[model samples]
Target chain A: MTELATTLEALAVHKQFCEDVLNMPGGEKIKICQQCGTCTGSCPTSYLMDWGPREIIAAFRAGMIDRVVKSNTIWLCTSCYSCTVRCPAGIKITDLMYELKRLAIKYDLAPKDGKAPAMTKYFIDSVHKHGRNHEVELMAKFMLTKDWGLPFKFAGTGLKLFTAGRLPLFAKNIRGRDELDKISAYLEAQEAKAQ
Target chain B: MRYLYYPGCSAEATGKAYDISTRALMGKLGVELVELDDWNCCGATSYFSVRELDSFAIAARNLAIAEKQGDEDLCVICNACYTTLAKTNRYMAESAEVREAVSGALGAVDRTYSGNKPVRHIMDVLVNDIGLEALGEKVTRRLTGLKVACYYGCQYSRPMGDFDDPEFPVTMDKFFQALGAEVITDFAGKAKCCGGMMMLTKEEGALRMCHELLKGAHDAGADVIVCACPLCEMNVEGYQPRVNKTFGTNFDMPVMYFTQLAGLAFGADPKQLAIDKQIVSCDRVVAAIPA
Candidate 1:
């Protein structure tokens, strides 16, 4: 094992990660979670999750960021906001999930061959290239880079959609490319400063 | 009613039917929707998960354009766009740090966001600006027997609950009723999630959620599922085959945008509404609706 993994396994929890989570937008509210499991109960995909919503919050409070981050729970969050609305303590569980996803990307913790992270990266890449998201290009890149089997898997649906004229041949580009470029650079600089 | 239309990326391609129906409905309702000039993506869920500021900035660019255009009210058709635009607008107006940083970013592009502009979804405009009574007056074909499960899905209600009950919203149900359709009240999955972005990344899990939604509507005896969001429609309608394959249950529930249903009720041409473009055939819905 690497030195970082050895240290992570030795510690009860990572204090710095706990503090980081606490610092996020909906992070502070997580302290108020009572482990009622309302969020998990309301979640539709929690069954497939490695760590349930309630358990993730408990892990966050316990300072076990490694357990929460290394798991596939963050990637599986659909951002439904059902957990947020149903929380008696008013914990923004969904927002915290988004924050966890952001942190997951920062640490490069997503599993190898994980399509979720790759899909997200491809989506951002599309926006960076074109001012708007191009679904065809995004799908093509995702299939090419992450999952080569996807194109074959979706062939039936693709043919049906293409025949129906639902799939466009090219993505529509927005005007004022320079403005988006400037805005992206400014935000990148700001984020670097925050880090 | 005049508004700036921000048709997100989905409306142009995958959700083109939604675009057609929205335009048809807006035209029939006598509402003017001037397409927002040079509007870009809202960064969807992906951008925000990668970098928060960039996603906010991208959405803010669209808001800044509307702000410059005399700050006309922005109407978004996609639920993701509505949520992202509204969330960014609120953050820009409420947070000094965000406002200053975003303003500095916009200044780099020679644009500004004073946070005076308003962003709303089509449902809000339909329910508030154009009352249901006025809509009822224009209905030429009342869908008296059609049973529709008004599915709001996610984002439309939650993380922001100004327009309707986030949990058990009746705005769509009531609107469908105004169009003379029997709205299904016992739909268990009315406010459930359709696994939005996961439809691409996690197909099996997304299919699981879609199956439940379809089964709920089917169990409730709904002839069709009516929704306002493009992602919800695509996930529920486009993936019905996979959902059935995953669950081993046969479900042929047709999903249509609420605007399409409204367009049909207002006696708009079916072709103009793009009713035939649906992945899951709306033939059942057509067969049921009187000519």
Candidate 2:
């Protein structure tokens, strides 16, 4: 809407994000958001959240990282990155969203809805346990994590695929878990120091 | 150009089509794919979600394997694997802080990733390096009149610039156009999540994503949806029925790896394209392409 500081915060896509993350090849380009409202207009879930891409960029420029983190907007981002390509300014809204998510977790702002980030956690844990994802185990563990009754919800879907030979129920779990753990431990240790 | 092609976990599993078609096409395009001697998973959606460092290290190890294999340049066929590996590779190569930490953690395993490798999604390789003009000449079968939409799933494109113009990416379109197919220009559910890795934890979201992509393609009058990643293929193909039932949207759309379609253009048989493997029958697209 109105100019917050007359600067193209919405236009400044790359600068709106963390400097470290924005420095990557496609990273720096998000800084040119001219805020034409094209992205918000095209976003299917824009109305579902309090703010759209324009506001998200502005908030970041206004030094509103925490506000952006604590809001449901970050979680709601289907991560379409529609704004990135759609923006005449060529902003990388999706990259900004990822950097925000990392920052949220780093600051312990991860939603405690007791589980939302569980998907993220399950994935990382799977990798740490094995160098590769054990699709079957990851699926089982994920359902268990959602709620004990959650598995029942997917039973019908699972059964349909079972008959088709698609859901083999026994996805081959990749081996070499010890090495995965070692690597995981190393990255975890580094992350801890960054905090 | 030489690259250590890492198909990630899905390349060997459900999305094997991506692996097979890519290897075949690479040879046609004059590139060599050296399978990592003992590469592992790159720890996609779930790994990065759980613990940052561990996921990075897990991803880092894969990068190390590729580097040791001696190709500073790499190509990832799966969208999710491409993103996760690129993230780790860049971190290992650029951040001494991350590299040393990952090295220390991986010390017990006797592995370390130098991260000098540049990971290019297969789409970049074909459209950028190989060039559409080259492919246009190589096309033995022009997919005339067959309408298609390029479904650049979240992993294959985003945080990595999401390829093309993130919003209006032209990667898939250019590739299809190279094959002489009608590339539909409609705003679709793609450029969004495929509800990958969420197949378990948050299926509602995943299903929503699936319905959107499939229905979007169908509604846009597309005959097929082309994809670049294994997880996207599995989710799009494997979850189509669930999405239909959950949303009551009736439409059969076959998702294909870009190479699969390219293989068809290059005169590979339907079997070579892995058409029958999809949840939806590929007879529709197969009937359109020549024998």
Candidate 3:
């Protein structure tokens, strides 16, 4: 129990995580959570894990940042934002999950649910190269880490799309690659701080 | 006033509704959508979930292009593209090492990324900039009896803030409200993932997640679900039949864009919303709208 309580201080969790995060731009109104379990109850991945929204909030309240951050339960969020609407309290657990995702990637604590953010670099590279999101390249790169047919079916769609002029073979490259670098640096600094 | 408009792949493809309506609405609001000349996909969902750096590069390519165009504010229409581009930008802004690596990767190219723009979701435009006043004027036909369920997909409002209130975002509802529709606020999923890319990969789980959300909306008596993200609209629409098949439930609530709904209420042809393309028909739903 002593170690279970180490991640965060019970009192500071809401203030730091809930309040502070909710104050951010895309955030706000997360504190409106009426403690309704609708978020946990409706979470698609809830059945797949041991932690629920209330429990996670309880954990957060208990200063279990380490536990919360380290727990695979955080990875369960598909970022659907169901709870954000259902919650009478209006806590943006999804946004919290996003924060946790960035942190997990930084701390190497993310799960292998095939959605690990570790693949972010490759995905980002593909976008930078093409100025758009290409599922084909993304599929091949992701499948490289897993099985073969992981991207087979999508190939048909990709072909159909390309032929229909829905997708261009080559990316229309953007010009300010340098500013993107600076922006990346600024954000990386914040991520480091979160870790 | 001049923002770099990155119309992600879907907006150019499956999200024609979004593309057309967004352009139309934004034009009415005095916003211009300048498609990045040589733009590509933002390496949305599948890209990063697959490989990290590659996705970053893909996202960066657009950033570089936007920078060259000298457009600082990048507004994207599709949720996936918006999320991908913004996420990559956020990541790039967050990681010095990644920044260096990505910069080094594109060192050979003349185009560079400044990453200075606040990548915006179009909702930010309607809710924030246009703010009811501009939209209200365009509502030639107010949908007095229309019941709408607002769906703000995950990336649209998550990651600790960017634009809307993630917990209880009302841009969709507001869009409907502006058109005189009744907003249905129920216990259905609002900010949850629609499993956009997950649809083709993991149908069952994805459909289930989407099912629950759509079901909740239907259960709440929503005539239609209003969404900002094109992927959400697509996923909800495409897999809707599968959901009805899986659950044996016959609810047929239409999934539509906030702008599409606005366009309809404004007396645009119901065809404008592309109800025919949708597996879940909006006929009864739109028919229910007060004349």
Native contact recovery (fnat) for each candidate is: 0.79, 0.38, 0.26
Candidates in descending DockQ order:
1, 2, 3
Summing lDDT over every window of 10 consecutive residues in candidate 1 chain B, give the lowest-scoring window: B89-98
By the TM-score metric, which is better: model 1 or model 2?
A: 1
Q: Per-chain TM-score of chain B, candidate 1?
A: 0.97
Instruction: Give the per-residue lDDT of model 2 (tens digit) for B1-291.
Output: 777778777665566667777877777667888887567777665444344556677676777777777844677788777877877766576566566767777665797665567788878887888788988998888998888888887666665563466444677887888788898866466576686655654567777878878877887888888887777777787677678788987767877887887888887776766665666677888788745
On TM-score, the candidate that comes out on top is 1
Candidate 2 lDDT by residue in tens digits, A1-195: 122224576335334335645553355565666667887775655665678767877776666655666666666555545565566766656556666666566546677653447666665565555555556666677666666775565575465445534444554445566776555555656556865
Model 3: residue A48 alpha-carbon error in angstroms: 3.0
Q: Which docking class does model 1 fall in?
A: medium
Task: For candidate 1, write residues A1-195 as lDDT tens digits.
Answer: 112335654342345456667875556787777888999998888999888999998887776667888778888988888888889998878778877888777666666678888888888777767778888888888878877787776777787777767788787777776677788788778868976
For model 1, how does the per-residue alpha-carbon lDDT over B1-291 read when each residue is reduced to its tens digit? 799999999888788888889999999989999999888889888877876767777888998899777546999988889988898877776567678878889889888887767888999999888989998898899998999999998888887887998898888888888888999987888888898878878888888888888988898899999988888988898788788777888988888988898899898877899988887788879779877
Where model 1 places Cα greater than 4 Å from the true spot, the runs are A1-16
Give per-model TM-scores.
0.94, 0.76, 0.66
Please state the Cα-based DockQ of model 2 relative to the true two-chain complex. Answer: 0.25
Q: Candidate 3: misplaced stretches above 4 Å?
A: A1-43, A49-195, B50-54, B272-275
TM-scores of chain A in all candidate models: 0.87, 0.70, 0.67
